[model samples]
Target: MNARVLVAYGTKNGSTAEIADVIADALKEAGLRSETRPAAAARDVTEYDAVVLGGALYAGRWHRDAVRFARRHEHSLAERPVWLFSSGPLDASAGERDIPPVPSAARAATLLDAREHVTFGGRLEEGARGFIARMIVKQGRGGDFRDMERIRAWARGIAKEISKAGPASPT
Candidate 1:
């Protein structure tokens, strides 16, 4: 049985989108069928056997659309196997050990029965910034700090869980 995984993301400078794609590819490579799409563009979660929700974090919060998506579909999502991920904390100077901590958004989602939630490092494009974002970047901070190895391992774990469970209709 093929597990249908929906990898949805909300991005500003496209970093989160790229992460979503990576996750989708990993899922596919692990023998699951996956689709990556923006949160706003997602049709419905009912058709998917598992859902991986992701979004870029800004100012210690998840992108608004992602939060809204989760709220709107909380009931439906609670009925299935769900996971969440975030792209934030571009400061890699902390190495892999001192990346502050996972913010409340990721934590709250985990409390909602998410199988897993990861905080991958985010990115900052040179010209892709608003006034506040620009200021943050100008502070000698901000750059892509995504850890692909960790991401791959996380995806592999999710794939294993889904494969073991097989595919099942929600409710």
Candidate 2:
């Protein structure tokens, strides 16, 4: 049977959720069974063989819900093959080079023993409710910086790694 992977994410303006969907799609294409969920709504990981947790960066900090999810599911997470991602920075920096995880994400990686943590570009557009977000869009400094191809490629790598393991073990 194929391994089931949970692609969970926390997003303020919904862009991060879209990223999670893309990741799940790539995982499925790579022959893994995957599901995408909002970090705050997902309550358990016992059914999944692996997890890919992602969050939106805010002022150098990870989204609060993502941090909470890690805390809530730490034990199950520790037993599973895990990956982390952060999507923020409405610029091309993520595609140009590697960006390290923020403080909270770093802690989650250590606590869960995640196989890897990756940073991806972000998008901020009109209709954002946050003051800073609205201001950035108004100032024309906000745009989609997420690289879809890069995101898919990274997910494929995760699929490859998981495929190399023996049959999926229940956690």
Candidate 3:
């Protein structure tokens, strides 16, 4: 059976959600079964063989919903293969170097025994919520800073690892 993976994320302004979708797409292309969801709406982790959790970074903090999700399902997540991601570097630094997760995300990774955590470039186009986002846009600092090809490559690596592990054992 194709291993089912949950690709869940917490996003502001929709960029992180797009990244989650890219990850799910890559997994599917590698002959896995994957589903994408907003972390707030994903109430369980036990039904899936593996999970990819992500959050949008704000002021060096992981998004609140993603944090809560990991906590709520901590034990179940620890029982399965898990990966974490963060998206919210409006600059090219994420592409140029490996960015570390904020404290909360780092804690979650340790708590869940996650295999890896990645930070991806973020986008802040017009219509992003919040006053600071608006100010950044008004100041002409807003643009799609996300590098899609790099994101895809990262997801493919995840797929490769999962595939190498073979199909999930029956629950």
Candidate 4:
């Protein structure tokens, strides 16, 4: 039986999309079959054995499409093993202290019985933003804050959990 994982993400400047791809690569290295796609592009959750949903956090909240995807597919996701992640907070100096308050995505994920939720640092590029986004980026922030080692470790952990859960049942 093959383990199929769906990595769905919402990106603004494409940072989250890159993160999703990296996660899918890690899952593949862990011996699991995974596909990465935009949240809006994914049509059905029932086809996958496992789901990994990620979003770019703006003002401490996940993208709207991601939230809707979880809410719309809550029933199907609840029955299958799920994981959630958010990308934001470029201030590495804050460490764990920079963790945002309970994001709506996390709350919804909990209600849907997600196995794990994580907050990964995000990136912002210079000149790749509107006035406000650029202002936020100019505060000596706006760099690739993604921790690949941590990301790979988390993927490995998820792979282990999925391996233990075996394959999903055909409906």
Candidate 5:
């Protein structure tokens, strides 16, 4: 038996979803049972022993669906080990100019007693850009900044924590 971990994410251009997939894969490799789904598909967190929620940041705000999911599962999440992540901000610099997760999302993370909230680099694809995004890209402010090694390291850390707890009875 292994702890079941849910890795749910909300994405605008599919970047966050791919990040979630890699996380789930890492969890599985570490001997935890993990599932990755869009936030909309994850209506409840009670069934999983732990949770990893992620979303794409938009104008310093987390994707709406991820925020909604956090609200909807507030109680269940509060009782479980939870981690939060957001992917956005094309700036390679990790310090200033990094777009943060919005206030409401931060509040939700606090309420859930999230183990950690990590903000990762993001990518803006030309093919997926909309009017405003295209304009921003045209201004030369677009590039892939996602650091896969950082993402994998974070997932490994989560897996290590889950493993330390040993197997959990699935709900």
Candidate 6:
């Protein structure tokens, strides 16, 4: 697909950004033009044919920058194909699917008629923390649980969707 795809993310300790980078790479491998950027720093979505918005979850909430970006570009996003993803479950063995930290923020998906909303495993490094997060890490719930294969599969799915819709003309 020749469509340009944006893999924008909001991360606290940079894990989510890493995931976004992998997803962007996967999209490129699938023959789509893709770029990754921090949601807070992304200028505008008007130039992209499709978007994949992702963020890290904390305390039952998605990173604020992702939510703000979705809200700020609701109308523009609603006009194009959009996908939503959340990464925050530190334990992949817990079978934690559908644990979106900010379901309300996912309203952007509804507004845009999004193709999918996925929740992937996350990572918690040894020393990365923010106050209460340190306590959670002490509980032995820290490690990298991100599945690169799963992430790549999801990006391929996005590429398929883009291909099905054909290239989108800039709005």
Best by lDDT: 2
Cα deviation of 92, candidate 2, in Å: 0.7
Cα error of candidate 1 at position 20, Å = 0.4
Order of all candidates by lDDT, from best down to worst? 2, 3, 6, 5, 4, 1
- What are the per-residue Cα lDDT tens digits for candidate 6 across 1-171? 588999999999889999999999999998999999999999889989989999888887888888888888888887788898888888884244565436755665676677788888889877886976677778887889998888898898889889989966655
Model 2: residue 33 alpha-carbon error in angstroms? 0.9
For model 2, residues 1-171, the per-residue Cα lDDT tens digits are 499999999999998999999999999998989999999999989989999999999889999999999999998888889999999978999988999999999999899998999999999998986999999999999999999999999999999999998445664
Query: Which residue ranges in model 2 land beyond 4 Å of their true spot?
Result: none
Q: What is the TM-score of each candidate against the true structure?
A: 0.89, 0.97, 0.95, 0.91, 0.90, 0.91
**Model 5 regions lying over 4 Å from their true place:** 95-100, 167-171
lDDT of 3 by residue, 1-171 (tens): 488899999988899999999999988988889999999999878888889999999888999989999999997887778999999988889999998899999999999999999999888988889999899889998787788888888888888888888755644
State the displacement of the C-alpha of residue 167, model 5, in Å, after optimal TM-score superposition.
5.2
The lDDT per prediction is 0.80, 0.93, 0.90, 0.82, 0.84, 0.84
Q: Provide the lowest-lDDT 10-residue window in model 3.
A: 162-171
Using TM-score as the measure, the top candidate is: 2
Number of the candidate with higher lDDT, 2 or 4: 2
Candidate 6 clashes between residue pairs 3 or more apart in a chain or in different chains:
none
By TM-score rank, best first, the candidates go 2, 3, 6, 4, 5, 1
Q: Which stretches of candidate 6 lie over 4 Å from their true place?
A: 93-101
Residue 124: error of model 3 in Å? Answer: 0.5
Q: Where's the lowest-lDDT run of ten residues in candidate 1?
A: 93-102
- Comparing candidate 1 with candidate 2, which one achieves the higher TM-score? 2
Q: Candidate 4 or 6, higher lDDT?
A: 6
CA RMSD of each candidate after superposition: 2.3, 1.1, 1.3, 2.0, 2.4, 1.8
Each model's total of backbone clashes? 0, 0, 0, 0, 0, 0
lDDT for 138 (candidate 4): 80
